[model samples]
Target: MCAQGTYITCANSPGQNFTGCACGQCAPPGCDGCVVHLAGGSTLRG
Candidate 1:
């Protein structure tokens, strides 16, 4: 399981990173992390 404060990185969109244990679900297989916030100030988490 991922611990809190875990760093995340997306392959498709490099340079963009986020930190959150729950963010693991947003990331694709083999990736450390993915973008949870989307455009227009909307979030993917909810």
Candidate 2:
């Protein structure tokens, strides 16, 4: 899914080709999308 209302899960989307479907909970081997954009300090990968 990618028509603005983004979505891209399905097992981390071909090994981290991100888009927008990172369903529900976050932990235990589950993550493909998170905080981004940096100018001074901003980062969270998982």
lDDT for each residue of candidate 2 in 1-46, tens digit (9 for 90 to 100): 3234343333344444344333344222455454322334433343
The segments of candidate 2 whose C-alpha lies over 4 angstroms from its true place after superposition are: 12-17, 20-46
In candidate 2 the C-alpha lDDT for residue 6 amounts to 42
Score each candidate by Cα lDDT: 0.51, 0.38
Residue-level lDDT of model 1, residues 1-46, one tens digit each, is 4443444556565876655434545465666435455434444441
Q: What is the lDDT of residue 2 in candidate 1?
A: 44
Q: How far is candidate 2 from the true structure (C-alpha RMSD, Å)?
A: 7.7
Clashes of each: 0, 1
**Model 2: lDDT of residue 32:** 48
How far off is model 1, as Cα RMSD? 9.6
